[model samples]
Target: MKKTIVTVLYLASLIASAQPTGLPAAVHPAEQLAALDGGFWLAREQHQLRQLDGQGQEIGRLAIKSTQLDARGHIAAVVDYGSQQVQLLDARPGQLQRLATLPATHFSVEALCLYRDPQALLHAFLIGEEGQGEQWLLSASPARKVRNLSLPPGVVHCQVDDASRQLLLVEEDFGVWAYPADAERPFQRQAILLKQPYGKLKGGASQVVALPGGVAVLDQAGMALHLVRYVGQSWQYLRSVPQAQERDGIASLAQGILAQGVLAQGVLVRDAHTAQWQLSRWPTKAPTKPDTLPIVLPLAQTDPVAKLGDAADDPAIWINPSNRADSRVLGTNKKQGLLVYDLQGKEQQLLAVGRLNNVDIRQQVKLGTQTLDLAVATHRDDLALVVFNIDSDGVVSELGRIPTGQQDIYGVCLYQPKGGGLEAFVNDKDGRFLHYRLTMQDGKLQGQLLREFRTGSQPEGCVAHDAEGVLFFGEEDKGVWTTSARADAPSQARLILPVGRRLQADVEGMALYHGPRHTYLLVSSQGNDSYVVLDAQAPYRYRGAFRVGINLDRGIDAASETDGLDVTSANLGTGWQEGMLVVQDGHKRLPDGPQNFKYVPWSGIAEALKLD
Candidate 1:
């Protein structure tokens, strides 16, 4: 018998799936124009305070090269270094008056302090510094001369006490010192050390306020708030509040710590007694209820991205309001990459994107005769806007990538003008949103830079309705801000939906949905595995929350935090490719581990979301 030879050939052809028939087929190269960069630039220019109004609508606009609001939020002082003029406006009254003026010089004012009591005529004092550490003080009135004041080294900011007689100087090192307003010499440096001069606090202080009976201080870390009481001779730590700090609206009261904002609602009363100090709201005589823990639905996937150890965040989902029954999701995998999936729990495609910070998608607005689905991917280094064409055959193609400089881009949105051809808005890491227009010419897109807008510090999330001509942006330390593309050349922006809740995690992702019952907003908490569903209409109720938990195949890592989510319900034609919830599974790569990515089905997530 001649030897028997057994050979196995596992040769399977890898063919691209034929474009789904019945839908529009997109033309190649002609549809290639990355709009993400256009979006980022628009966010940057629109980040400023475009207009300010008081109690009602439409008031005279406040325009200045630079302006700073006082601590009380009552007055805004604008001294245009270039114009050599100073103006004061009653922020509440919309009252603009030329308070005083200054000579054109290299020096500029940095802060405005007003007396707590209005009876005092001394409009507090304004402190500023110039070349060679030269310090000058000006009277709130313009007629007053700029008095030279001898100040200590590294005086970054200044504040006044209730009596306006004592000046609180926040040193560059973040140390607090008290100097008499009439003192001739620099501060006699009686520093109020919160932690008894621990090995030099990191980052230094940002804000400091004197609390009732004690001084409340914010650390350089920008994370915790501390209260120090004068224990006879030395400063003693009374208590340190983290989750309930000012950013979250929890303040210290005469009786105890009063927690306000979002953590105070829903529940009748807290656990009453716990290891942590408790503050009771007066139900009968108790305090009012505080916002309770937001409702969350955990996807519960244990894979790397959904694992607790992974530094994941910023999740968005696309859902068809007409048919909530089927939806799809697109999310960023933090440093890992971006993952996409269908509504039936099947992985469609996994692109090797680097450190994808955010993923946003909107219906292809008809630009000329072409309609394209605007898909944007942002990274820490640059903004990539890849337009995908939903061709007549229903096939999606990667058209092109819009590239900005090497900087982090966080938020992205499509602003579809009432007419056609969409303008994309993107929030950059530098705290601004840049706008760009996607023009369809010769069967292709040519991205043209439109303009830029000022926004809050560290803008991380954005949602826009090009058809409505409105744009919404979110900040980590600030609230949700809105701006109109249809507004004047200056572009009007304001805080429309203030985030009353002080979140441990910064608001990173936002999705807008118009439904029969109401509009809905889904926000992602990047620091923790939590998502808040808010009513888009009426009172904007706290609808619920969703997170990544075990039932969703996410392991019991107990440390998973949610980031980036995009919900789409293609079954009902919400402009999504199909029914899928695209979510970014924030998973870290192990030293010698396999790749990282997670995809959850729309039906699978529905079950988890319905857990209540």
Candidate 2:
């Protein structure tokens, strides 16, 4: 026994020495940046590719509009923005090929990544935005004639999960779409990771990312974040994250954005005042420093969420109107119900949501109680209206359920009647809008349907106000409609995105916020994952559609589908509130399985509205 004990001690020492020490030594210093690879390819706005090392140091420079890197620190393909062409570089010794013209009009290179076949033929998949759908361009040569990869329309971003040997395509509202990369027809639906549609948000066009054990996702509803793992034969929810309340301040880095089982990066802010670009870098267990510092990039346009695909879904803000404060936000998930976020968009709590759909918070409420804000939500399976007391420990309860045949009800609203009573309104899948009288006794909702109106078919949006004595809504196949407090009044619904433009008018969600000059009507469309802002007073003309992505054919061939839409106040940020909108994404499950959650910010929306 003593001999065995001595032998164990000797073996234990060998194991101890084999393990790496948790020390604070610099993995790659500024002077030794070339030692590291596999990081984000950093570049300036002019499309100048600046090879940044792990320590955020420039190791080399390549004047190209866009670039994709290989395992080693070498440029695979470089696009010449001026001439609209591509230049291939030799892998062994980095040298660019003279000239190569790609058979794509206005072909700008983006979403570049490397994928290899089982035979070890390393190929690069590059996606570009041409017309309504994205162009899938694949290349095996560093700069050979770019091959057109025939894929389904609506593919916005893609990734080849080397571990799963499959391609994952994110279609807006359809769910996490997967396809076997090795198959001849590599673009057929394989498996749906998870899908739950909340009113306005589409189940397709969401984002996906790989985790240690399984995959995680930001649901298309823009209300929740989820983590799912394949156990025996089914996908089960390992964890769920809640929704975030829209705020005005910037979130600090100390309080990281939390989702699934890991840390999430927050908004990449470019300090216009100081011309410095600040990126939120979450701490990882691996010994590493930030890839980029808080310095302005070479080009002016710097939207970090641009290339992130669908990971950006939930929107949150710090309460103090600054990036260095503690804060909370409200968000949602497809599997879980509602989620409240802290200052950093971290999951505060995941509420037990039952068929919960779209959620909107009333800001600038001068109510006496500290809980001034009110959250309104639509339901899926039932006509239930989920209402929450907007306080620190706010509790969301069923305010009242509409009794119109438990079909598909999408929109909900809280309005006080001029006569005295408070009213609740809900939209239905079949063409009708039901109005209810909300009777909240001791913080519990007890209600009944007061009246029902024919608002064309598939009423998608609902907005009402007692003070103004006006209610507004819109239909999917129809156009915008409005009514008054007078019961005998005839409802007047107008065709906003009229006839020919009706192709672009699959209205999904709507919100009315008090703009500086006028009340802006924010409308949603699942057809293109876009939104339109209309003038409140007169001439409700077009406000350019907000553009987002749907990577439908990274590896999977998918039927293009878009759904779910919500518009937050531009004042969601400080001062005027940077007008931001969160759209739900559906087809985002990738091979090897990963989290696919997406939310986009329309800082440009605020600018166009002159709010910025």
Candidate 3:
């Protein structure tokens, strides 16, 4: 029995050596291969990656299932199937250090490729199978951040050709699909090369070899390979290459040589230079126009301030009752002080009030026997409420300073009750709030602390609806909370909008737009760069949210990262006949200048939102 077994093994070895293209006698065979600069990587049996030199000499080995090289061949990414992670390795000579490991979710990684964008940033594209014919494309950075791209189901294989800047994927029943490998833009479907029922291909595509202008597909169609080109936005069959034996894997090598890996026979080399390979540029798709929403025209913008960063934070508007055209907007420049702008957005007055954060206006406050238009703001430098009395000529003069008695003062709003007298609600960075009542004593305004409350977290952007006796404030990381405006009212606060429901964290500002019978509460969802409006009445149901998109008519940019906003129901003149909304744009990217306030017409908002 031992002699018979030895004779069988000897015959098997002899038959393997007599094959047309035979590999070197080794214990394990290569399942996958990737050619690099001076060497190549081989995925051998037992989940090992063997690095070989040009002379076919083994240099180093690692436990990886799949391997790919970056466009510059400076980095190599290997897939660890058992660990469910992709390992990035430095591909320099004698320095095969693992740089980073990115976690993957799919159960099995079928294929792996490396993509380098025009900026020379390296990315790893991994095709993972999650069972039940489900597949996912994961684009991962070296920092382990992954973005999953949705793909058609039943993807068999994927490859990237840096020379042609194309990403090719083979589906089970659907043929080959092409995508642009540019990392700067989002992945878009380029075209479908071939389908099962229409072409001469009988079975699913098992492998794909990327050529100069197109790709060569190897399927089970009479055991032959076919070349297809993308021309005129469609796939056109070029030619076919007859194969003597079935090739399991094919790779484009240097010097115009094609390496084909056969099952029993080793690697076969063929001169592809003689083939009439069509070399054509991939058709560039026309840029699709961005979906334009209703334009919110910016009537004017505040003059760019000198402060580079953290200059503009909040804004408040006070309309001149006698002259609607003389309305004034007061904006806080955190680094400078307060700036007063007219209806035309021209800076008419500048007060060096020292580091004020937020400002609000209260009209017709009867102080003793005198009526006053007051603008109160949070004085960050002194932790006090800085009051300003707006004269009939639209000029503002300092009234008095009242210490908030808090370490940090953030948002401030004035409430003038129907019963007369004015109250200021001031909040600190730690969510603590103090309500102060303003009165005249000896012909001078004085602020007396009436009540104090806490919102359990950081809060800012408070507004008062005096008619309804309701005060709304945003709890920075939480949501909008409403409470009583009267000092004698209950301390219990009700949440109008909770965190994470249409509203994101750090809810920055709150404004009220009072219509004829309906009122709406607009909150700045700073985290998502959106504005959410809700019914101001009880059960404050959510209306819709709209982003201040680009306005090409006025050549003004969109509003984002808004801190404070103010909307008025009273009509101003000219373009603002239906009133106006003023918002502090944190990022003033248009024309590339400093941050400033953007004036949006209230009519546009009402018509766009269909708000009565």
**Best candidate, lDDT-wise?**
3
Per-residue accuracy of model 2 over 1-612 as CA lDDT, tens digit each: 000000000000000111111211221111111111243223333444444433344545555553322221343444455654444443222232233344454445433334444333344555453312122223322223223444444444344544444455544445455554532222455553535442222354344443323344445444443445544324455555443421111111111111122122222222223323333232222211211111100101111222232222222222323332333455544334566654323455666655465565553333222324456666565566666555434333333343445477666666765565556677677776777765555545556677777764676556664556777676766666566744446556555554134235566566665545666776655454345567654466555444332222223211112344444443543322444444444333222121222333445455544442
Residue runs of model 3 more than 4 Å from their true location after superposition: 1-295
Q: For model 3, where is the 10-residue window of minimal lDDT?
A: 1-10
Report residue 374 deviation for candidate 2 (angstroms): 3.4
Q: What TM-score would each prediction reach against the true structure?
A: 0.44, 0.46, 0.56
Query: Which structure among the candidates has the greatest TM-score?
Result: 3
Q: Report the lDDT tens digits of candidate 1 across residue range 48-162.
A: 2222221112233444544333323333344454563444544443343344454443445554444332212233345554311222223232323323455655554555544
Q: Candidate 3 on 1-612: residue-level lDDT in tens?
A: 000000000001011111233233331254444555543433233456566554345667766554333223646666665576666776555455567776555445555567543323455566654311111112222243223456666565677655445667776555667775543123567654565476656666655656545566766332556777656446677666566544554543322112223221122322123211111112222222222334455777777655887689898989898998888998989998889999788899889878989999988889888899999999998999899999988898889898878989999988988889889999999989899998889977788899999989899998999899999999888789999988999979998898785888779888898888799999988876677889999999887776674444454555768899998988898888888888888766434568888888888887877888
Whole-model lDDT per candidate: 0.43, 0.42, 0.66
For model 3, the local distance difference test gives 0.66
Count of clashing residue pairs in every prediction: 108, 70, 0
> Per-prediction RMSD in angstroms?
30.3, 23.6, 19.2
Q: What is the lDDT of residue 33 in candidate 3?
A: 48
Candidate 3 accuracy as TM-score: 0.56
| CA shift of 243, model 3, Å | 20
